[model samples]
Target: MMRMFLAAAPAVLLALSSAQAEPVAYEFDLSHTEVSASWVHQGYSRQSLQFTDFDGTLDLDLETPANSTVDITFNLISGIWAGAHHEAFVGHLNSGDFFDTAVSPTAHFVGTSFETEDGETGVMTGDLTMNGQTHPVSLEVTLNNSGETRDGRSKLGFTATGTLLRSQWDMGYAVPYVSDEIDLFISTEMAVPAPAE
Candidate 1:
């Protein structure tokens, strides 16, 4: 019994250690960033779009870096295409042909799994929901940078990209000139928690 107790000691201690530290929460910096998307419209020409706001929470445990997860929620109805394309782009995007924002006002992405493919580059599998439809997708992510600055501040940043079939979510409206491929882009910057005061 003493030997069994000794063998179980480390496992029990690790569990206690994990339970003591809470997940780190970080807010993204939007000012120094852009959230944009592109898709082929005429098989050769590409069209681009961007959203105005992104609100979400990210939870990470530096010890188990691969176990981190991020929840991002964005306003679909507030998206802007930025040009003379506003009228047709917004109208059609909000219509049944694209996002159908009238039926779904928001889009959400929640991380599920992480995998490494190359040196410091990886993939994050998650569920992406838009226009009342949800689908499992993976994003190619690269850990651009992570470290502490001279100001006693810690930081981490990454950029992710993915492509999804528009028709998978019922966005099949194409005038024979539009494409069904949608390119997604995500960039994030995070800092450590505030010091105890």
Candidate 2:
């Protein structure tokens, strides 16, 4: 009996180790990702701009969602306005009145914590740095789908929405007219890199 108990100890330890899965690394599939910002334009309509150039990574732990993390960066210089007078509008947006790309060329977000009752949805809290200012922001995040590709690569998709006041970041050029509140919309697909031979 004593010998049998000792032999089982090693197997138990091995099983415990295998159960503790490590977080999987995933890179954003830019082709399937979109990050946009919208704000009310003088109550006439809501104006929107897209972040054309950006990159992000996710460390996902399916067994322990709280242990997951994400980091993203946006190139403000790549901001685009989809509207009439496109060039002029984009130029103004990049000027000092708005994002001021010359001064702060990039905005970054680092997720600090994620809270959820179920693994499919959660509130992600992170520090967002923009226009030389960093503030805490929370996004309602949803895991849309996750599966394995035909090539055996893992893939997952998510959608997130949040709102922030432009004034909080000191980019309030037109408060009453342009609407100080800014709404954020993000959709992204992430995938594990193909294994190298």
Candidate 3:
């Protein structure tokens, strides 16, 4: 019995080491992150707005991409409308009819599952909460680059796009006039934090 236990010890240790390689944690580089949305304005043209402040986390499993996940929180009050009618449009966006940022100041997204389309393209299904309401949303994502930076930190960059109806989240201020369908896009770079001492 002692000989059998000793012979299996090496194999057990190897298995544990391999398992530890999964699910590498990463932090978003906020300086390079951008989340923007756009929709048709009375069918004349499309208007775009960007969320200026936000943070998020990403857990990536390169070997098993399906096991990855992501979570993000965006400040609803940070919406910026860079248009000729900037102040007026921005105020309308923040008023009770639109985002109602005064009452619900934050929006969130938490990924539940991930699926790969090819090597670097994938889809993430998650729950999105906005205007005090939550609903499921799937974002199409693509890994544009992944490598080590000059400082030796591992980094990954991606762009994601998703479409959702504003009315579904109770932000339907003007359905046909402003367009209920919202096209959202996110471009972000993430880095693996240094290991602790």
Q: Which one wins on lDDT?
A: 2
In model 3, what is the error at residue 157, expressed in angstroms? 1.2
Q: Which digits, one per residue and each the tens of the lDDT, describe model 2 over residues 113-192?
A: 66665556667677888778888777777777777667988776777788888888888897988998888887776678
> TM-scores for all candidates?
0.79, 0.84, 0.80
Candidate 1 C-alpha lDDT tens digits along 63-101: 564445567777777755546747866777777667777
Q: Given candidate 3, what's the lDDT at residue 167? A: 90
Off by over 4 Å in 1: 1-20, 117-119, 149-151, 193-197
lDDT of 2: 0.66
Among the numbered candidates, top TM-score falls to 2
lDDT of 3 at 49: 78
Whichever of 2 and 3 has more lDDT, that candidate is 2
Give all candidates' CA lDDT scores.
0.60, 0.66, 0.65
Candidate 3 Cα errors over 4 Å, as ranges: 1-22, 63-69, 79-85, 194-197
* Weakest ten-residue segment in model 3 by summed lDDT: 1-10
Distance (Å) between predicted and true CA of 46, model 2?
A: 1.3
Candidate 1, residue 73: how far the Cα is off, in Å: 0.6
